[model samples]
Target: MTALGPEGHRKRLRERFLRSGLEGFHDHEVLELLLTFAIPRRDVKPAARALLERFQSLSAVLDATVQELTQVDGVGPHAALLLTLLPRLLERYHQDRWRTVTTLGSTRDAVRYLQGHLEAERKEIFCILALNSQNGLIAVERIQEGTVNRTAVFPRLVVEAALRHRATAVILAHNHPSGEPEPSAADRQLTRKLRRLLGDLDIAVHDHIILAGPRYYSFAERGEMD
Candidate 1:
């Protein structure tokens, strides 16, 4: 290929991506390719490098809020939106993929499914995986958010969510944005409370999984669910 300027460089990047899908690409190159879609007709290399330098990592750049992204030089609203959209898009993709799954019989199965749904969350999100008689997944519902503190309304919400799905069993789930898989005292209390409440309704609490990034804590694994 002949040497051209910025336009040629962008074209080469596109061609290389099509040929091999980011395997040999540098972090800045990946950002440059993504920025090209939002910022046409300009040399986006500097902008990409600047974003990486500011954010300190590729994942951090994608995870950054639009306001944070727009603070960087050469990053406009359009570019910022494009960058911020990637993680949500990925989350939706993973969610859609898991929605097709019919059964979640093991802790590993449940963990894999929930990680895709909750690992990206920046705050605590309490959710339930409603399951049918044969351990087939009915639906994953978000019951509460914020901290997992006990509230008078929390049990009612859990019951309502379980009843809403007609779930014979449920797997409780919540994310710990702090990236520690250990269950807090509140988490344990809530699990015990919910298990007892759901037991009266003839519903089983299969597990309570706390997600902290890639790590997780499982109440069932520790025999706490019993």
Candidate 2:
């Protein structure tokens, strides 16, 4: 039998992954394994270590821009693109999983979905979860991409999105990149004004949710949706 080499080591890593997943794999090992797919026939250990050193964490590595990632040694455009694509791929996976949730039965359900959709966002993006007459999820539409204040999120766009989705009810949602779930004065004002504008069209604003990392603020839960 041939003695173990880099290829053998990679094979062993794959076998180990097939056996127990990433349960005990170090961060660098995970990066090494991933880089193998992008950069074949190479010892990816140094590249993995370089990535960890440059980005500081596995999450940060996955979140890095292509330009930022390519700045690291041994990370070319293909590797950088693969790393940057991971987050969006994971989001698509979650959105597929979310399709199983036909109805958001409670505020918690809506919050959970919104958190998955918006929590990792670096910039503020306003979205609306359109609900059918029976509270079933019709669609999740991104209305605006920018700061989620009154000036940034116009009523006409929100109305257009809601009407386009044919939503009887909607749950307004946005993310706070600062990781503070507390609603700003502008947030409050926008919610009130939109509630009225949407109400005029006989559309109900069920809740306004602000996702801040792992935390969230719910206007409905806080008795502010009235």
Clashes of each: 0, 0
Give the 10-residue window scoring lowest on summed lDDT in candidate 2. 143-152
lDDT of 1 by residue, 126-223 (tens): 89999999999999998877853322228889999999999999999988777788987888888889999999999999999988878999999998
- Candidate 1: count of backbone clashes, pairs at least 3 residues apart or interchain: 0
TM-score to true structure, per model: 0.82, 0.80
Off by over 4 Å in 2: 1-5, 115-121, 147-151, 213-215
Model 1: what TM-score?
Answer: 0.82
Model 1 CA lDDT for position 110: 98
Evaluated at residue 46, the lDDT of candidate 1 is: 91
How displaced is residue 42 in candidate 2, in Å?
Answer: 2.4
Off by over 4 Å in 1: 1-4, 24-26, 147-153, 222-226
lDDT of 2 by residue, 1-226 (tens): 7447678778878888999999899999999889988988888888999999998988889978999999999999999999888878877776677768999989889987876687567678899999999999999988888853322788898999999999999999988776788998989999999999999999999999988777889999999986
Q: Model 2 reaches what TM-score against the true structure?
A: 0.80
